[model samples]
Target: MGYFKDILKYEKKYRRFTVLNIVFNILYAFFNVLSVLAFIPVLNILFGAEKRVIDKPEYNNISDLGNYLEGSFNYFISQKIISEGEIKALSLICIISLSLFFFKNFFRYLASYVITFLRTGIVKDLRDNLYHKIVELPISYFSEKRKGDIIARMTSDVQEVEVSILTSIETLVREPLTVIISIGIMLFMSVKLTLFVFILLPVSGFIISSISKKLKAKSIKAQKETGTFLSFIEETLTGLRIIKGFNAENVIEKKFNNSTLSFKQLMTSVFHRQTLASPMSEFLGSATIITILWFGGTEVLNNTSTLEAGKFMGYIVLFYTVLNPIKLITTTFYNIQKGEASAERIMSVLNTKNEIKDLPNANAKEGFNDKIEFKNISFKYKKEYVLKDFSLTINKGETVALVGQSGSGKSTLANLITRFYDVNKGEVLIDGQNIKSITKKSLRGLMGIVSQDSILFNDTVENNIKLGSQNASHDAIKEASEIANAAEFIEDLPEKYLTNIGDSGNTLSGGQKQRLSIARAVLKNPPIMILDEATSALDTESEQLVQVALEKMMQNRTSLVIAHRLSTIQKANLIVVMKKGEIVEQGKHEELLAKKGEYFKLVTMQSLS
Candidate 1:
């Protein structure tokens, strides 16, 4: 119920649709009861049980209103029987019942129709909000979570919320009103009987509720297992070549089967408990009806109660009407319990605190000048420090290369400069301003990054190049491509710039993909460029091609080049050699060779001296 209330907060925008749905449901409930009550006069007329009333009943106060209306209806029927035939009177009663039923169904449809807007609108907003949150959360958050699990919350969990929570909304609104109206009339017919009904109903409700008590816990488990299998599928698709090459298909298959089996068992329990609501409520309702027949029938037969035969039959029919809604309400309750699990999962993501965000008074930084400085910054991903007391500075138009072993924290510098992860201690300053005090968009706007992996979407080559600079004209894109040495291959492609690159740009060769990445950076034309192992994965031929483009793009740019290949950084203005988390040496390439220190050892290890 707490989760349900949270979900309803998204309904604020669709209040008009919600209001219209409620109004129509109210009318539907009213006419639904009236339709059953209309059968009373028909039963009396058919059975020759109607009492004659020669005098018309008078208008009266609220307390006498019930009897006054009954007497007035009796007088009108008597005149109809006298003026017309009994058959015509029966026809009139049937016509009234048919019309009541018509309006009941019509308004029921209207309620469903209007609620569609609210239901679908909320689902859309929930997905949109979840996606936006996912995009805004820090990269560290994803490093701690499974991509497939997050995807499950976005797709399946949200869909579960729609199925389990939202679909029950109409029943929640309509059925309760039906139950209330029908019960009110039943109480009017016989207080003693209605009170007895109240006792029996709660007992049945208690039993039904006890059965569904564990449904939510099971549903949560089931939804979680869904995420597990989805994660497996995503991993399998991503690593299918490895799986096949290793001949581990059977292992992967058995693991997936186990996940599905567990999901099956949990869902089996959830659905069995859910399906029990219908038959249990129906059986309980039948038991209550039989008991009422015994008690009410005995009183009517022995002349011990106010209920006559026809009105007593109508009372039985009215109680039956209440039973259906009570069953639906119980089912709705079960569904809400099931949906609460999914709602909790969704709310968990939407409610996640983004640790990285712009400060309220943060200023937008438009350009970089002088130097980019890391002032004694200490940072860590988890427990141990990745960068401890790390300090460095890169002046404008200088290409400073960070050369290190794999765990030497070369890439962490790029992350820090871009504000991807704020330092645990000290500050990163652009020019002289603390990077934290700059709006993140503006801070990132001043630098362009080309990482080890070519992160391109499945889109046109032109669109991929124009990603950050979306408003770049065709000539600008071509010029940037030509500058990065990508125009050669791009022009050779089937559709040239308009060509669609496959997923992650898998269709492009390694060198071509890296050049496109460089072209994308060139198009953004940022003052500071961070190229983190941008050509580390290429073949020697491809490396040379990409290296040429890298030099071309780094010309006149304040560049931070994180590299593993010592040969590539030989021409860099400054080379900083790092081991563990600290810088061991910094010098011009020739000066470092003369030092014969850690930088010299790295060059010797790479056989580049």
Candidate 2:
């Protein structure tokens, strides 16, 4: 219920629509009761049970208002019968009943019409907000979550909220009004009979509530299973090549089948409980109506009840109208219970605290000055530290290279400097100020990164290059591509710069993809660059071409290059050798090779002179 209430808070933006819906629903309910009550006159005319009234009844005190209206209507019908005959009077009554029915349905449609705007509007805003939250969340958040699970929340869970919760809103608003108005008229007709109805309703309501008590818990399990299977599907698609290559298709298929089996079982239970709402409520409503019929019918037969046969039949029809709404209300309750689970999942992501965000007084860093310094920094992904009390300094325009074996915390330095993950202990200072004191957008704007993977979208070559500098002119893009040694290949493509690269730019060779990444960085034209093993995955010939592009991009920039191959960093101004989160050697490449230490050992292992 709390989650449902939170979701309703989004409706404030569509408050006008909500007000319109309520207004029309009120009209619909009023006319709905009137239409049912209209049949009373027709029944009286058919059975000749209404007495002749020559004079119209006078309006008096509010207490006698009900009798006055009923008397006045009967007198008019009697006049019609005398002047026009019983056939014409009955025709007039039918026409009046038909008009009442028309107005009832008209207002009901209007209520549904206006609510459509509110429902679609809320769903759009919810998706937009969720997407913004996902984008703004720190990179480390995704490291602990599955891409497929997040996709499930964004897609299926949102759909569930729309289906179960938003759809039930109309029922919640309209049905209750219908039930109230019908019951009020019933109480007016016979309080003793209505009182008995009230008792029977609460007992039925208690039974229905108890049946749906565990529905929310089961719904949560079912929705979570949906995420689990969706994650399995995403994983399978992503790693399909590996699965087939390893001949582990059977293993993967078995795992996927198990996940789907669990999901099917959970959904089966959920549907069984959800589908039971309608029939169970209908049965209870019918049982209550039967009891009322016996009690009211017995009294009417003995002439003790004020309700004549015709009027009692009308009462039963009016009570039957109330029954349908009560049944829908119970179904709505079940739907909301089911929808609350998805709402909770959505709110979980929306309500997550983004730990990395700009502070109130954070300054915008416009340009780089003196040096970038890591002062006694410590960081870790989980328990063990990756960088321990590590300190380094790179002056402006210095192209420093970090060389180390795997798990030696080379890339962690790039992550920390870029503020993708904050240090556990110490500060990363740009010039003399702490990086944390700078706004993230401005901090990131000063640097361009080229990682091992060339992450390109399924767009044109020019558009991929324009990612960092979206508004760059065509000439500027061309110049950047030329600087990265990618212009020759770009011109050879079918559509030149307008050529659509397939997913992840798989249409291009590894060298071409890496150069495009460099071209993107070149377009940003930042003063600082971080190259994280950019050519490690390329072939020998591709490495030479990408290396040429890297050297071109690093010129006059303060660069921190994390390298796996010792050959790439041989020409770097200073080389730092790391081992187990500590710097073991730092010198010019030739100087370190002369020392016959860690750096020399790395170069020797690489079979370099």
lDDT of 2 by residue, 1-609 (tens): 999998999999999999999999999999999987877875675557776778889998998888898888888888888899888888998899899999999999999999999999999998999999999999999998888778888998889999999999999999999998888888889999899899899999999999998889988988888888888888888788999999999998898799889888878888898999999999999999899999999999999998888888888999899989999999989999999999999999999999888889999999998899999999999999999999999999998999988999999999999989989999999998999999999999999999999999999999999998989999999999999999999999999999999988989999999999999999999999999999999999999999999999999999999999888998888898988888999999889989999988888888953
TM-score of each: 0.98, 0.98
How do the residues 458-569 of candidate 1 rate in per-residue lDDT, one tens digit apiece?
A: 9999999999998999999999999899999999999999999998898999889999999999999999999999988999999998999999998889999999888899
Residue 36 accuracy (lDDT) in model 2 = 79
Residue 277 accuracy (lDDT) in model 2:
94
> Against the unseen true structure, what C-alpha lDDT does each candidate score?
0.92, 0.92
True-vs-predicted CA distance for residue 451, candidate 1, Å:
0.6
Q: After superposition on all CA atoms, what RMSD does each candidate show versus the true structure?
A: 1.4, 1.4
Worst 10 residues of 1 by lDDT: 42-51
Question: Global CA lDDT of candidate 1, please?
Answer: 0.92
